[model samples]
Target: MALIGIARLASESELLEAKSRVTYFEIAARRILNRTKPNMPFQWTINPYRGCEFGCKYCYARYTHEYMELDVQDFEDKIYAKPAAADRVRLELRRIDRKDHIAIGTATDPYQPAERRFGRTRSILEAFARERGRHLGITTKSDLIVRDLELLREIARANVLSINITITTLDEKLARLMEPRAPRPALRLKAVRQLAQAGLVVGVFPNPIMPLLTDSERALDRLARRARDAGAQYFGAGPLFLMPCAQKVLLPWLEDNFPALALDYRKLFEHSAYLGSGAKRILRARVEKIRDRYGLNSGPLEYRPELWLGEEQASFELRD
Candidate 1:
């Protein structure tokens, strides 16, 4: 790991102890826009915030915190907002054709608690609102999105804007444990309601479909129904993808709280990145049935050897 100033660069360690509050500034040198793969329907993506404040117990994005010289456990409590992000967006946009598709918060929740102060994600959305023939996707668990209803509506009128409200489990108690710092599940559902009322195509992502955790067939079915009632276009879901740093915190949480499922999780992921082809096929088939029953049919992601050998496939089940 390298450090310029006091910023700690991430190292290839297996565990993360802690981090600091000192913020850092860096420009994202993104080139391509829309991306396509066998795993996901959309190809292009943009992640405004790096370390998420939500601190989801099973968050795979915790590895991203390592890049900043931090561990996955400290990823939630400590944050680093991008500097001059709006201007940087303008600069990046000026260089590319504005007609491409872009997805935000793919790696981290853009409207996390820190967003109330930084507002960089909101600013970037404002920039995209003025763009024509452009396609954009937003995945968040925050109701702060309701603040940009007018702008999002405007963008949807001219381009493509699909907002995916991620709800791993409908059980609020489980939600609190899984996403301690994130917005309440009810508020997130409200955000979906408000966005749909404004005529934007909304969806729900009951993702990284934690096996034996939040993957209760009835629980998932209920979530799909809730989103559908809120006027969501569809619902997408999959299985868990664990990362080393994330396991530092998440595995312990699992052992302490859901001890019954701990061994099952090990069987699913300890030996390899995936839960075996047969297991995934069964789970996907189950999800298909749940979505069919509740009408939460959306799309999914890709995981191929050419693009994502081992680590890449881990990201495919983002639940990051």
Candidate 2:
């Protein structure tokens, strides 16, 4: 088959039923590693799946589905699982320098409900367990990651691995409204506690902090306190940036749930996706104070592997 169009590609995908609400499509993958832009913290990223089932109203990654000529809604309703992901990732890792950082789940939740059935993320982790001296980070909102605890610990022994559990709020009701299909806030907190107890570097990320929803000092402070109590070593937050795709879903959601603030959100993001400088400064200052009070690091520490062969020696050997 030529795979001429998105429809053809989709039709060719092998469908697997995981749950009544979620469907998984197996697709052939050309590559697994993606080089990151300069501004991103990591050099490379790997997403074993495309489309997240969590269906977060404020999700920024919805734009990804547009690349495949699919409706934005497909980003949640239709999930794509890459076949041979573990083998592809293993081969791809050989091309990347071990010193470069690889971040998993940057675009999609690798441990979404589909993962339980497909086990693609687990396969990738098993491959990574065989490697050494690599800086790797995985982020998810699901407690299902606990299923891979032993494998993660094994990878941590030889590689620098950090697990980031994203908890948007401590309130279950608020979280359900924001991220309707994600695991409960308490479950994520428990995952953080378990990962920390296992001696794994664990952190809490409250990203896309919705203005007037989760950006309050008291809200963030309470979240940080809970994270600290759960044994998380770091706490980080970023204000929400509503791109066009996100706005399509989030605007209506705001109107239905927080009608009074809906217009404010529209006006704020009408011209630009990013929040204003003043708003960012206020949030940063608030987070800083909370982190300071909780004795939590601002972000995960960069892991740099020791260099056994000096650069000069390697260059000379290559020249020879």
Candidate 3:
């Protein structure tokens, strides 16, 4: 049996050596439940897999490993495919009285590279189709989502289904280093376009917008315009956070890549890894204003609207 931990990285060049290979396994979960109203949007959720493969350097989901008593495991290379996720979700839905809605890939990307090898996402969607929930949302940085378009259309016809494609930068050089294993930004942008054309409520999540990096006013304006033109119905953005474990791993990567700015990151993150409430307010206000300026706002924006449902949350490094 495989131990519970992240697979070790070989070398910088070795890490970039691409092969379609992936590993998968079963993770017996404790429970599956619906979202009990009182939030920003939906109520039902599902996670077909744990850990991700997109390998984005600044991913905030790294803290998810804490539940398993693991840390700084890259959140991507560490694999955990819940083979029985669909069956478990189905069994639990029967016990609830109300029509439940959910957010998938909230803790892990359901459409990661592992899904392609394991076909777990397919099984989960089919399960959803059988006795579809009321509302469902999926967030990811993969173009793999395009593969399930037909399945999504069948369920989205009646229920609430939304796809949020997370895109932080359109710059290829930035994306290559940021999300080494993930598809290029253009591909995901194309996926958003294709998904929206199918009449699904597609949105662009310019999330974890780093402090000095892609958080620039110009970066936001450019991406918002592209998303809008490509058919994104809404836009959501937030500041990048330097959660504890993530800081340890990501700060070094920053130092290696942008040596001059490493010191700035130390100072910006000095106040707090997470943005202070005042900082959040000011930044949100500015992002909203920019979204409005670019016609990218779909509705009112809310930040950290509520605590995640007993899920592990991670933060990313920020530059001053």
For residues 1-320, write the lDDT of model 2, one tens digit per residue.
Answer: 34344445555678877566667898655566667655446777777887899999988777667655677888898898876456667888899999898888877898898898889899999889989999999989999999999999999999999898999898899999989999999999999999999999999998868899998888899999999999999986777878888898999999999999999998898899888889989988999899999999977633211111111111111111
lDDT of 2: 0.81
- Residues 65-172 of candidate 3: C-alpha lDDT, one tens digit per residue: 554555556356556765445786678767754445567776678888877777777777776676644666788889999899999998787666778898989999
What are the lDDT scores of the predictions, listed in order? Answer: 0.68, 0.81, 0.69
Q: Looking at model 1, how many pairs of residues clash?
A: 14
Candidate order by lDDT, decreasing, is 2, 3, 1
TM-score of 1: 0.83
**Model 3 Cα shift for residue 211 (angstroms):** 0.7
So what's the TM-score on candidate 2? 0.90
TM-score of each: 0.83, 0.90, 0.82
Model number with the top TM-score: 2
lDDT of 1: 0.68
Among all windows of 10 consecutive residues in model 3, the one with the lowest summed lDDT is 7-16
Could you give me the TM-score of model 3 versus the true structure?
0.82
Q: Candidate 3: where is the Cα deviation over 4 Å?
A: 1-23, 32-44, 97-100, 298-306, 312-320
Better of 2 and 3 by lDDT: 2
